[model samples]
Target: MMRPVVYGALAVVLAVGPEMAQTRPKEAASVPAKSLADYSEAMENLAEAASPAVVQILVQRVAPVGQGDSQHMGFVAEQQATGSGVIVDPDGYIVTNAHVVQNARHIDVKILRVDERGQAPHGHLLPAKLVGLDSQVDIAVLKIEGSNLPTLSFLNSDTLRQGRLVMALGSPLGLQNTLTHGVVSATLRQLKPESPMVYIQTDAPINPGNSGGPLLDIEGRIAGINTMIYSESGGNEGIGFAIPANLAKDVYLKLRKDGRVRRGAIGVIPEAITPALAAGLGLDRDSGVILSDVAPHGAADAAGLQPGDVLISIDNKPVREVRDLALTVFQRAPGDELKMVIQRGKEQMTKTVAVLERKNEPNLLEDQASYDAALVRQLGILAVTLDEKVTAILPDLRRLSGVAVAAVPAEYAGLNPGLLAGDVIYEVNTKAIASLDELRAVLNEKKSGDAIVLLVERMGQLIYVTATPE
Candidate 1:
């Protein structure tokens, strides 16, 4: 019989004897017992005790407009997707991945039940509703109403150390309550531009339905939430990533309180100080980020940072590159106060900047020196230009305007690294761009050294492309 892994609030220290013991027999006698030490062995204990709290999520999602439904039927087709979730509160607050329950019209949650052999696996199915979802971090909270519901306590994910033993609990490929063991492969991985910007990379085998499942340390503490995988085979190739539980908890609380996560930024376009720029700026080292521009009324503007300023640190963390600044600022909430260190015109200064939330709409930056119009165009295509080899297999995209392929001219070589011309341009940067004028309007404010995020639509697929203008 299969069972859900044990997840609980207080660490259970197994004693040498029956009643007081939470520690396994092999544990060193002098070491203090913390939680369930043998994750694999604790699987059955958690399954037997906490199985009712683990749930199998089934979502019925409405098909999109062009999703190939028979028009004569008069009803859009519904799609079903499966994933795993954990009940986090007795009031029925459940936590899962935002991508898992995205667009779900109906959600069914199945709790585990004990069989005759004393194995607890999937059993009862109940209805649930979305409480809040934060797509940026890929975390979602759900709730089901009932009395005496089982809940799991959140562990301090920040305490997790790299190379520590851990386990992943989820329904991988619909295998309810499956357990896989691994070590903390890596930590603080930045895979997205969004806030709470860190992930716990693990070697644990995670599958499609494993999204939103818990990544538990050996002591049974929730370390992260399994989210994404880097795979070409469309399956786990031993490379999986999870949103660190600390970041997830922060996002969860924000989502629970405000129904959305509000992020803050310094409002200055930043880039890693290259060797050339470092030398041009007369810097001793190329180990800091260069402040490119400060937008009008932007946070950095109010803080008095200038375009030529070299940003060395933020909140005491060295800003060696753009990713460092991005990941640091993204971890902050809107309205949070931040300390920055900058070198400006032969003088070093410190400034306190009140980070501000960026608007959902695009804020164009003016650059009269460059092109006639500095605009961000949304083409809604996720594509890269065909290389000599790829051109043989992919068709050519020409004569499309308003939004078209981004040419890889000398200055634009690294703009859209992974996109090709055949990819349809659906969105210019982040602004929804339907026409060339809209793209132009958005770009009127764009300047050099800005990393533009383009949302592209290609081959009926959507992808985000990050480009920086030279």
Candidate 2:
């Protein structure tokens, strides 16, 4: 009986071992390898189709000698910076970041040429002209001498949702034609409290040289323009930000046509109503936007808008936050009217406010002033006293008397003075300065290399700017 049992166990083991080996091999072979191969091939095809429109940007600009420290005084040097750009029009219109070409004396764009085998082997560099740049939005338009160039079309970024697949293509770390993939982390991200502009946030592994590159969707359309990265070690940490294609497209068209952007505003300070604010102020509702202040004699004031009024809607669209109101006003042109509904106490009322163009933009001020007469070489800025002519073109000022910066001369641009066009200088070293002569007199009193503090009004805000005489 023992011998028969041993023989039976041996037979069972032999049969099961061979069957297990065969079944394991068959399971390992059924991994859907063809599906993975097809997915990779699809990605490769997308990259091949989209790469021709992307370009590497090389810029040479006059920079301060001590590694961009403006305190270096008049001493300056030339520096080269690398970035990326995307062709937007077939006629050679490229979109990039303004910071990429700011103060650039020369700009070269490297365009790639695809071979018959669908691979980019080599490319040519072309000189690009700065058509226009708006630093407020960090968008610039460039023109090259080419016709029927490869281009990318802008996608409706408003349709972009979190978790959507996206791709970032640029010259990261100066490596050209680099592509990184990730998903949208967020939308409508405002980095600053006072800023009206918003950015698209992603985890697309952006690096130093990725700025101004195009962020693409699965279909190879422009979803946004890669602008910045949130990293602690100066490398990609899987967090990046981009300017939405909708805003970029608007700025591009405006800059391409007029070389500047004209933003509109209604003279009221809108603030987001939080739960704490509602409780503190005894508001009727705990959410939505509220009027914190109404500018005296401005459009909102003329429309009978008052502080403490809760904004319900603008132009039939709901105003849920300050961004809602701000964006609506920003998109409107001067003289456009917005029908607004507001809740005040127990009464809800509708009002119409006309949007006013913010004429105090740096470019507009530069255009309106006479450079020869307004040139103030001491501070390297063109100054105009707040006389009637200058006042007529400017927005409401904090003070009626001051010297306004009209432009920064190209000759002294390398000096890197902190002053910008449209800044109204109200005080020099705590002394009131109502005219350019007064400002010049104050500067003349100071010796070269002496530090001076200026109290200036810029974009309806008051701030102090410090600089040394050149």
RMSD of each: 15.5, 9.2
Candidate 2 global lDDT: 0.86
Compose the digit string of candidate 2's lDDT tens values, residues 119-232.
745678999998988777889899999888899999999999999989999999889999989999998998887778889999988999999999999999999999998889
Error of 1 at 395 (Å): 41
Give the candidate number with the greatest lDDT: 2
Q: Which stretches of candidate 1 lie over 4 Å from their true place?
A: 1-52, 64-76, 113-122, 192-197, 362-470
Q: If scored against the real structure, what TM-score would every candidate get? A: 0.64, 0.75
What TM-score would you give candidate 2 relative to the actual structure?
0.75
lDDT of 1 by residue, 421-445 (tens): 4444556565666554556566556
* Model 1 Cα RMSD, 1 decimal: 15.5
Please give me the total number of clashing residue pairs in predicted model 1.
Answer: 40
Clashes by residue pair, model 2: none
Q: After superposition, how far is residue 74 of candidate 2 from its true place, in Å?
A: 3.8
User: Model 2: runs farther than 4 Å from truth?
Assistant: 1-32, 67-73, 114-121, 280-282, 361-470
